[model samples]
Target: MALVKIIGCGNPLAGDDGVGLKVIEELKRWGLPPGVRLISAGLPGLTILDLMRGADQVIIVDAVEAGQKPGTVIHCKETDLARVTFRSLSLHNIGIAEALSLGRLVEPEAFPRRLDIVGVQIAEITWGKADLSPLVAAALPLAVHTVYNILKGGGPYA
Candidate 1:
């Protein structure tokens, strides 16, 4: 099993919502350690379950609507995920909370030992707005660093 798996979820065509995938791209530039897998889960809201299998730890990075400023990065646990919803990656996909509930019922044993969410607060997720807003773009480094810290030595949030 992979020691840590990082799944970056988002729609690149949807402006700031793309920060998740962008962070994966940045991580790609740096050499990743063995047993650490990075997945660009673009719009894979429900399918995330499959990507999560076989990892000891799973870190999901995505856009979140938490009534906060656009660039804020929030590290969320299971309880926190229940209160915050990821910016809709698709019209048909269910929320992260529902997805986790399903996972618990259908395949709880397959879940990772540790699950964390690194969410970037977004103002909006317009389908055709291909560019991230200035604030969100500026926050990309911070988000990436957060993921790196967790992967390297269990970040403060951990």
Candidate 2:
């Protein structure tokens, strides 16, 4: 059986930047499949490495500012991460891309065989803000569905 891990990363205080954490919270209520694990990996950084290690497959959900309209949910493979620029509101030395790359190098056997990212476009990342923007809030269900599809063996972006 494959170990599928869903890790959501973001800062809960940074407005729309917290969409990842919100999605994770929503998923908890819906329940999860067998062999699947969910993690609220806030602010990522080096913590993602630990969260992903030993997983056969991994899905990371986070906010990105890639010049798209706010609330747009984008699905991408691990290889595609290099093309998309992630938005960071925290002071992390290493972002998701760097962390995954280092993880693969440090533990080839433990590194995930498959990896995907569910990114939501953000309109703002203002400090002291705890709620998501209306646009992003609306996209949460779609993001959750997308992650569900992937975990059910529907494949990436199904």
Inter-residue clash pairs, candidate 1? none
Q: For model 1, what is the error of residue 34's alpha carbon versus the real structure, in angstroms, after optimal superposition?
A: 1.4
- State each model's CA lDDT, in order: 0.78, 0.83
Best by lDDT: 2
RMSD of 1: 2.4
Each model's number of backbone clashes? 0, 0
User: For candidate 1, lDDT tens digit of each residue in 4-81?
Assistant: 899988888988878888889888997688888899988775688998888899888887777778888887666566
Residues 77-150, model 2: lDDT tens digits: 87776666654434356777778777878877877888988889898887889999999999999999999877
Best candidate, TM-score-wise?
Answer: 2
Return the lDDT, model 1, position 156.
41
Worst 10 residues of 2 by lDDT: 84-93
lDDT of 2: 0.83
